[model samples]
Target: MQNEKDIVIKELNAFLQGQYMGIRAYEHLIAKLEDPEIKKEFQSMQQDHRLHAAMVSERIQTLGGMPVNNEGLTGKIQGFISQMMMPESTENIIKMAIKGEDLYGIQLSEEIVKGDLDPESKNMVESIIDTDRRHLDYLKNLVH
Candidate 1:
């Protein structure tokens, strides 16, 4: 098994890569959304992702790893799906975005429960998870 530092660095890098991917995917989704309110919420989500991405990247560097700036494999697949699928309707767009958010939250929750992070790192992940929960709630309420 990898050591604590290695595991944390890998997790943080994965988180950063995921956030960047979400940012790009959301931007693509935002353009197709016709509702001003929905578009505005997505823009807010994009901003939050950007903030998280920066935080994770900084943490990765602090852990003696080079921060990843390019899109990772998952990001590439997501980008491809978003572009190729071409969500034609607002409902489709919401479904796609919500699905991505749900998966991200689930993955983060698992990492948090694994109990490998140092105190500061754990705190950061928890805070981000809280923000993610809020975002998911808002999206669910909006869709209903």
Candidate 2:
């Protein structure tokens, strides 16, 4: 039977994978953006994603679980294409992605914190959620 630690690790691993997907998507979106400022915001968000992944990795290790190494084929291919394409319009792309990410961040945070999860897992999720809030705020400012 899996222990509580093991169960938490599984959930953390899944969450990490989602963040990995977000990072790649943002990177792709960034590549298509033309505005230097908006590009910078995307880059900042990408850094946050990396930090979130690192936090999850730490928790996984703490729980004696091996995290997944790859972002999977679809994420890699899509990220590659997004990076390769020159964005036709910076405003639209940034706005769309920012809204999506903001919504995702809020939803994920709520789920992680309010759901029936272990204490350790909940704490980590909350921490990541805090970071996401900051990212959302930054992106919101860009819209104005």
Candidate 3:
């Protein structure tokens, strides 16, 4: 039987892994993109994911939990797919980015609504969720 703190740690670690996955996805996109402006925007978003990963790692450590160092199997599979089948058009790239961000935003929102995290962790997640919304909005704008 897992206690609340342990469950929270597990959830946080999962979120951290998701951040790493986002970073990798952005990297794959940036490498494949031909446009300098879009690549720059993706790089910025990737940096934001890095910052989010750092914050989540710090909170996990503060809770006496070990942070995951890698993105795990799902990330690898997603990376593989991105490398093999990513679209060539700028609009398609932006749409893909928006989809990823939207999914992440939904995941983060679900975590908040779950009420499983401690106050500090919840606050950090809320901050990340706000940034995710901005990312989604930016990508959506690029598609319009």
Candidate 4:
């Protein structure tokens, strides 16, 4: 059987990866946005994602695991084009990101429960899910 340390390490790595993904998504959105207020919010969200990644990385270190480098490429193309022209693609991209986040949250939660993860690790994942939900609502409000 895997040790508790291993389980926590795995979960922390997963959470860190998720945070990295969020940071990339928000960075893309901010680059595409023109409105000052919306851009500010996106920037703030980006900072939050950085914090989340740091926290998860710390936890992973405590659990004796090497944090995995992110390999995200979801928003690169759309973000670059939107950066040049403030198009109406932000809403769709944000919506798709939210959907992806929700699906990821569900899967992570299930994994936490089923795997040998600790309670603290599970709680951290849930907290990240909550934050993602808030971000989704904020983006949806902007769209509508």
Candidate 5:
């Protein structure tokens, strides 16, 4: 059974992994999509995820946990899975990314609200979640 500290570490790692996963999705979409404007937009979002990943990594280290590098095996699998179907249109890619961002935002928001994180960590996470919300809103606006 995981204690409070263990749960915190686990959630931190999961958030880190999700950021990596998101970055990979952006990179893949940028490469696969033919539209220049859409690709550029996704590139910007990828940079945001990189920043979030670094912050999460720092928090993991502060908690005396080894941050998983390269986004874990699940991240790798997800990258491969996205590659398998390869969306044909940039619009489709944006829709898929918005869906991912929505899910990611919901997951982290719910976890943070559970009140498991320390005050400082919770504040940091809330900031990151805010960024995700911005990304999702931007993607939706871009597509519509």
Candidate 6:
């Protein structure tokens, strides 16, 4: 039987992990990209993920739970796979980013709809979701 605080902490930590994954994925993509403008945009999105991670970690600490500092095994595996599978083209990278953002947005939406988060956490997640939608839109535009 998990208490409310514990549940909230778990949710926040999961979100934080996702942010870490985003940061890493962006770094990988940015390193492969050649266009200055595209690289700059990816860097900006990566920074946003960093900010999101910090905010979520702070909230988790406020709830008396330790935030996860790394993206965990799943993230590592995914990163490895991406490194092996990713194409060199800018369009392909952007398309991959779009898929990631879309998936993350769905996950965030599911968390919000679950109604387990405290008001502050829910608000924060909502804000993050909005940023993710923008990121998704930007990536889609770059590929299209």
Best-performing candidate as measured by TM-score? 6
Error of 6 at 131 (Å): 0.2
**Which residue pairs show collisions in model 4?**
none
TM-score for candidate 2, please give it.
0.79
Q: Each candidate's lDDT (Cα)?
A: 0.80, 0.73, 0.84, 0.66, 0.81, 0.86
Which model, 3 or 6, shows the larger TM-score?
6
Following a full C-alpha superposition, what root-mean-square deviation does model 6 have from the true structure?
1.4
- The local lDDT score (0 to 100) that residue 81 gets in candidate 5 is 83
lDDT of 5: 0.81
TM-score winner between 2 and 5, please give it: 5
CA shift at 132, candidate 5, in angstroms?
0.8
**Model 4 misplaced regions, further than 4 Å:** 72-88, 104-114
- lDDT string for model 2 (1-144, tens) is 977677777777767776887787776787677778778878988898888888888878877899865566765775576556534676667566766577656675476566555787788788788877787777777667
Write candidate 1's Cα lDDT for 74-141 as tens digits.
77986887799878888888888887788865465556536677777778877887788788888888
Poorly placed runs, candidate 1 (over 4 Å): 112-115
- Structural similarity to truth (TM-score) of each candidate: 0.88, 0.79, 0.92, 0.73, 0.87, 0.94
Supply the global lDDT for candidate 1: 0.80
Q: Which candidate ranks first by lDDT, i.e. highest?
A: 6
Cα error, residue 79 of model 5, in Å, equals 2.3
Residue 144 local lDDT, model 4: 80
lDDT of 5 by residue, 1-144 (tens): 878777788778877888888888888888887878777878888999999889989988988888877768977987798789778887888888888788765565557546678777778888888888888989899888
- Model 2 spans > 4 angstroms off: 71-87
lDDT at 28, model 4: 63
Candidate 2: lDDT over CA atoms?
0.73
**C-alpha lDDT (0 to 100) for residue 67 of candidate 2:** 88
The better-scoring model by lDDT among 2 and 6 is 6
lDDT of 3 by residue, 1-116 (tens): 98988888998888888888899889878877899988998999999999999999998998989999878898788778767878888888888788788885556555643768
